[model samples]
Target chain A: MSPAQHEPDEDPGAPASSHAVSAPGAPSAARPKVPRRVAWRRLSTISRARLSRGTLLAALLTLVLGLALVAQVRSTQTADLENLRETDLIALLDDVTDRADRLEDEVRSLEQDRSRLESGGGDAAAAQAAQSRLESYQILAGTVPVSGPGVSVRVSDPEGEVTTTMMIDLVQELRDAGAEAIQIGPARVVATTWIGVDEGRLTVDGQPVAAPYSVVAIGDGHTLAGALAIPGGFNDSVRRVGGEVQVTEGEELVIDAVHEPPTLEHARPVPPSEGR
Target chain B: MIPVLGLVVGVVLGLMLQPEVPGWLEPYLPIAVIAALDAVFGGVRASLEGIFNDRVFVISILSNVLVAGLIVFLGNQLGVGAQLSTGVVVVLGLRIFSNVAAIRRHLLGA
Candidate 1:
């Protein structure tokens, strides 16, 4: 490598003359004018490239690694399980336990009913009537799982702007559309059901519900869906509050939620003849 | 120069596409990325030392990712996945630091 080819002020301690040997041209006034340092940096990078093809290969590999790093970081950060704190873990465990208990109780009661029906110890007609009455009571009490043709409504508040009033209005609209049985998330909506905001989160019967909230109502699917899509109905209200409502009509919608039956403390059934 | 351009393009593509890594591969991705980073830093250091070899760099990159993943997989099979993952990360992290230090000294003359 010639002395003139190398910049006099380039790093004297640079390990090798490979850069000078591979430099495209010595700095000259006639050449396209760039600052000496910039030219030196560019030439050095080019010279490094000329030394071996490995530098380019390494760059490509680094590029891929960079992309993977960014993607992995994002995925890891967004992972819900990974971000769970101790309280969140405990809450998840509680939820699982509650669900398991509910299912077990349901199975046990259903097995008992089947055994009673198969034994045939009672009068068939009277037993049938009693069974039908029990089912009606269970449905009214919201203590029995119900499934039939209905509409499923999903509400999402992406901006956290949905208020309690909007949800109340939604429920009222569903009832007006003749919703026989309704469920919001895991809570069954009944006469005693309470919906409110607790600490900025929507809660049903004191249990926090997360978005997007799925509401399943057993009723006339077309009527229920139409009710939500009316000119200034639930859908419009959701939009006005920076939320979204998606209503889907389906032939079979299952709402397998059972609420605790309310106990009557003061009120009693009046004698048949004395009823006002 | 071409490699740098490729790198920029790769980043843009990654951002635009946002490809999902499979759930099964998620566990190994972080380790693989760290191992690849170690190889990249080592390559930079070697280049500054005038001993950069493309074949060696490529081989190291492949081996690093494979070996890191293998260690984690084996650890999972043996019921010690978390411990072994930590071990792999610590070792690779040290190597990355040393290589980065070398590169800094070479570039900054400090």
Candidate 2:
């Protein structure tokens, strides 16, 4: 379109002159062979332009392919994260299962030991030895059921104002007062149970507590009551925190309960002669 | 022209030799091949730029080494270090193909 571009078309060396006919209606002499080489060179130039354009298209395709690969890598990373979480869950479940199996084996062994002792001739010496062994096992199990006359402290709110921390603190006080086998509501208290707020209610073992938490202990009832009555005891703390704690005693407080603890799966059975 | 043809033939041979070998030697082979290709490409770029200097060659070599090392490190950290080291192989494959094509077109120009 520019004047400078038109000047090239008019140039004698230009490729356009290879096809140029001089006058519109007059017969012209045949052209020499030199312009034919120019035409071939021009054709080569056109082919080079087409090849360059094709290369550009290839470059564009390569870019698109790289982007698709990046998307695939991101999706794979997400899947890997999910697999890690599943691996953790499986490991935890395996641990719990292993513990349960150990407990089952211990129960089986104890039942067998007891049966052996009862079936064996009731010699005084053997009975004494077996009783001693049973006592030792009970101590090791942390579940030696103790029954005696002691005080039972019941803390509750008829209007429901008791907090979980208050309940935990109260349990701690009872524990300090030498209460064995403490249970709040239906959930049997253990060493590792984490007491926390669940929903709007105070809960242990996933069970919600209604009012009046009954806490029973097997010890000297008078001594236990005195211990709670002392300053900084559960009663004092409860009163200071505006919570209720009441203590009473009876001739006998039986804690007829059994805690089936977790079992171990992979441990070989302990030889009876090997003592810890 | 013979150098270009030799480079092409060497790359083809290397690609053919890859899978038949064990994995422990695999990493070194690809890295060596890539380094060699990078040197060849640097030579061509330097000739085009018409200013040959050791500095450009050194920088190119350093960059190639760093990039290849980083890719391998990332692959290892992502837990597919051994199995999917083919990522490095694929990149090398693309580079070799493009380099061979470029050399061929230049030698057989319009």
Please identify model 1 stretches exceeding 4 Å from their true place: A1-43, A46-56, A81-98, A106-276, B1-5
Worst 10 residues of 1 chain A by lDDT: A8-17
**What class would a CAPRI assessor give candidate 2's docking?**
incorrect
Question: Top DockQ: which candidate number?
Answer: 1
TM-score of chain B of 1: 0.92
Candidate 2 local lDDT, A37-129, one digit each (tens): 443444344334333343343223223223323333343354443323334767988999999999999999999999988777667887799
Point out where model 2 deviates above 4 Å: A1-123, A132-146, A158-161, A265-276, B1-110
Cα displacement (angstroms), candidate 2, residue A199, comes to 1.5
Q: Number of the top candidate by lDDT?
A: 1
Per residue, candidate 1 scores C-alpha lDDT tens digits across A1-276 of 433253321221233323321122223332223344543464387454353465567567767886787778777767877534445778999999999999999999999999988777766798889999999788867998999999999998899887778878878999999998999989999888888999999988877888999999999999999999998888998898788888999898898999987688988999989986
Give model 2's DockQ, 2 decimals. 0.03
lDDT tens digits by residue: candidate 2, B1-110: 22333344444444444323334433433453454454445334222222223334444444555566566666667866554446566555454443344333333431
